[model samples]
Target: MIGGGAAAGTIVASADPSLPDRSAAELLVDLQNAKVDGLSGTIVQSADLGLPKIAGLTADSGGADLVNLVAGSNTARVWYAGEDKARLALMGTLGETDVIRNGDDVWFWQSKAKTATHLTLPADAEGKKPAALPTGVPSTPQDAAEQALDAIDPTTEVSTTGAAKVAGRDAYELVLSPRASESLIGQVRLAIDAEKKIPLRVDVYGKNAVNPAIRVAFQQISFDTPDAQQFTFNPPPGTKVNESTAGKLEAELDKEHKAAESSKPAPAGAEQPTVIGEGWASVVTAKLPKASGDEAKQLDGVIDMLPKVSGSWGSGHLFSGSLFSVLVTDDGRVFAGAVAPETLYKAAAK
Candidate 1:
């Protein structure tokens, strides 16, 4: 996983050649040869984005595709054809473009906000493909599927549960567990189309407050061919685009982050709290809970300043610092968990 959204899910590679009625290599050629009039799929996702980047710690809901790849759409396009740009999430909420490039550079460009930040891409960037593009298009099902699939370790365990229908399509039920990483999904049961050879639904599990409490399920799919026009966008005039390289903005954000952290009071009887004049995102992660005595007390008070949260069910707890999350139960008990605690703090703090 990359960003804070990174996690390990059990990866299951089908040994059965998904050929309609040909050799496996021919199947690859046929699958590649087949043309999708339009590709549309519904997405219900629960992510643990981690914070100080703050917004990363909240649960998010939305759907998009090539049809609405610009302006009002929560869509992004990357050159998955190769490593060009690994993935792009172009929601303008933060007034910036979130670009994950080649799994090594993460740059954010916000015009009106005049803020640009960069992060090092995850180690997995090397073998990855882009997640989206200017127009809604598929580099290949193999590429797209692998992008999601590679996130899971193939060596993890798997089991078949039963059968079900997804988006009105018949599907096989199965559960998967990551043998090593329990980050993204604790366990997942997928609804797959044994015929079309595509996933009908993806259920992700986690316990972090910002992530889904039990699991997130996506239904309502329309792989109906999408119009070709959905893949690109026209940038409006007068929109200034600010961008940061892999590490440019961190220095500035870190400065402010450190300053606010220093202003906090220290533990009782201790010298004043350590004052970091100019702080960055790292400072928020450092000053969070786990402080002793006065430090912890001050941190708790600071946490109380956050907006109170709850689900339709009564459950939520914003941990000290910028940990975004809510309770998971209809009765409200389980915490959704942190999406991106340190990232969230810095974002909310701003």
Candidate 2:
């Protein structure tokens, strides 16, 4: 769900689009049972995380299109036909980046860099591992909706936002709000198609915010199966191609994990991530890799940009954003969550 093309403005839902009455519980069930075999659409994703601008840090800089996803807007065209065939083209001002998966063959292409990466999946791996796409860039509303739905539990309060419209289709809006006051997330609103029961838009709001801090939605869509040719990829002349198999990548990851484990001391969970809380207020704490020389200097410079804070848990630089907070401690540990700074401080103390 991660490849897309160009940047597009946000799509506003139609006002007061009337539909048959539906309860929150019924919609939840519909979302849970929803299924789509084939579809193609243009997706618009935007984020306004309220992060301070830093020099030389932009989405388009050095082909860092993923970075732009957190602070700006982007547009992508996506085509999906069942689980084995899918394509996403991320359009940009300079060029386009695309990820295509067809059966056992997967391709990643960057037009500006004239480079392509190809991976041949094992027959059994075909539909098992998701295509590697930029993290946090929901290629479709369904992707975002699935993530939001995962947070549903006793810690969440679910309700209906009534009728709405997305991508010119009538939809029902469902809202999920965190019960914990410390949770920075205000609510996650999902617009599900009335006829199809599939999500067409997702909006995430910060605590007490009127507008969404992040939005991912389809601007145009079709339920018909996309052309089979959409998933085919052939690199142009002079393009640098690197190839590997899924089995080789898995072996490399296993080797790295074993090496790391062997190099660590015998203490259990020393290098493992620890969950500090449950549900929306959950904080994840992990040990940062020890840096030296230029890496250490660069890390220090970046940390210096954040505000300094101290408590019984010690001192660190705290980055407070619209929907999340991150505390990078001087002791080479990082704690982060969709929680308040105080919640992070509490987690650090443990």
Candidate 3:
């Protein structure tokens, strides 16, 4: 079951809570088998990826903005009764955005815009689920933990740090680290509730960094079933409403897939992406999308802001952060990964 391995680091206790000791394998089993019938809680997500500061890119900038997601703190309220019944409300200074899923009906509401989108799932799509929040932000620790766990393999070293306390409940700390030297990531920690066996917190640290670059945890939580009204949505007067169906979405996706398959293939290394390396050191290389007019000018302006570099790999701009590196080549190609800049440079050479 070990898919990845990494060297272990010193573990420090967060709290002196008494709890039974568990092995890393046992904890993984518990997390995989964990189940909760219903719950409601406040979730806090924060990130400090050491990105360059840009104007209007702070947390105050709309909650759904990509810059806000990676650089500042955001809070969201969540309610879950089961796989099909759930609600998430993201709070911001101006207003709140909510996503509610009750059975086959899903609603997305943005109070500031006074707009709502509704979609009905196909009857035969049994286990299909909707996103709790926007694309970048993870709505809960469980959501973040699942992503981290998926990276576990023989190349990862998994172990329990110690007992800890979170959200006023006892928890066990599990750590995963990458063995690949090229990986920019140092380690990932998950705090699993001792009693519930569900993850309550997740922390991701950059290589040799003291503080976490990304953290998603619960500030407050309740295991009791939430009120049914929490999942109900009634649009305000004059709110713009848009409706869609799963069948239509599936048809559109299928049409696009068929079109792509039938289209003439581009010359080698033209537009398609290539994967270099594997696991944590993997880098993806692809051609930048063609732009023109105003979009082209905007893209050039942004590229100019990044630091320029040159070598056998050619000349382009480089964007390096605590946990990732991105290289844009003058030849219209881009390389990015959760790896050191040297790794990206090697990929660019190929």
Candidate 4:
């Protein structure tokens, strides 16, 4: 269950008597205009995606664990000075891993592997950074909620859940619920700092579930600017560094995308991931590349663990958990979503 709204609820850092009474539309406007010049904090992320307890399925990077929709929790320290300077240090069982971005330089360091990868971006005369980089590390809940708030529509029922404490400060809770019944997502609650107008905590609940399945929040936070030296990084001796440029990175990603597309058994003129519906109940269907030889046998072993189901469309293995389900067909197609198995089956049949 979501314990509380980050440390905001626990710490009494601010003197606000209570959350400011505001209408849903007013809160939306405040969130849209939210801005932070500098900040530092400790963030905790927890996930109970209802993944199968598959033995030996461990993540390699601390960054990967932070965003992987699997079972577990992790903590990290974050310092953000601005778009040009930021640092994240993730603490894990293996060891601490750091991701530092200073000006045009980006570094990813894994202490356990004694390896670091560096990247340099080309200077932009306009002085505008790219919108985003596909780093595989998904944004934290606060970031995701901010992005989602900008896309309010009929598919989502938006409202306010009143005031609450977070990070020792009073906060207003903004709630968004999916209107579609097929959606596995029940609702999302964002704890917004009453004064700063920034989200300090985010909680996502499953359909009909009393508790959240995923939560990310700050345990402690401060609005003060972080030290400049935190953004600097020097690779330790004996560390393997694979350096690359922005252009090279883009080329590599393009090549990989094309190769993956070629491998999938997609129908002529059809997209790899085709959405059958929209909103919460939407199911994404993809044609997967068929495995052969030992790989096929291994895949079969995995299928055996899942519940077998069949329909007029095809036969497939169904994997269901708390908040997500996946249908892997014998014909090399996969359907997955946060919706129910019946919803997934309906998509597969179509």
Q: What TM-score does candidate 1 reach? A: 0.37
Can you rank all candidates by TM-score, best first? Answer: 3, 2, 4, 1
TM-score of 2: 0.84
Writing each residue's lDDT as its tens digit, candidate 1 over 165-206 gives: 665766554444444331333545555555555554555455
Q: lDDT for every model?
A: 0.39, 0.81, 0.82, 0.73
* lDDT tens per residue, model 4, 1-350: 11122111222222245444666666666777888888998887777877665433324344456445456677778888887887778776667778778888888888899988788877861243323423333345457676656545567777776687877877888787777888788888888888888888888898888878888888899999998988889888999999987778779989999998888665555456888777667788987655678977887887777778998878988887777788998877889887888888777777
lDDT agreement of model 3 with the native: 0.82
Give the TM-score comparing model 3 with the true structure, all chains together: 0.88
Clashes of 3: 13
lDDT of 3 by residue, 39-80 (tens): 999998889998876444333455444555688778889998
Model 2 ranges with Cα > 4 A deviation: 1-18, 56-64, 125-130, 252-271, 311-313, 331-333
lDDT of 2 by residue, 1-350 (tens): 11122121132323253566677777777887887889999998998888766544432455345666877788889998988998888877568888888988989898889999898987787565346565634467877887887767778877776577788888988888888899999999999999899999999999999999999999999999998988889899989998987777679889999998777556434588889888889999998866567977887887888889999999988887899999999887899999999999988888
Give candidate 1's error at residue 81 in angstroms.
Answer: 6.7
Could you say which candidate leads in lDDT?
A: 3
Candidate 4 lDDT: 0.73
Clashes of 1: 54
Error of 2 at 47 (Å): 0.3
Clashes of each: 54, 9, 13, 9
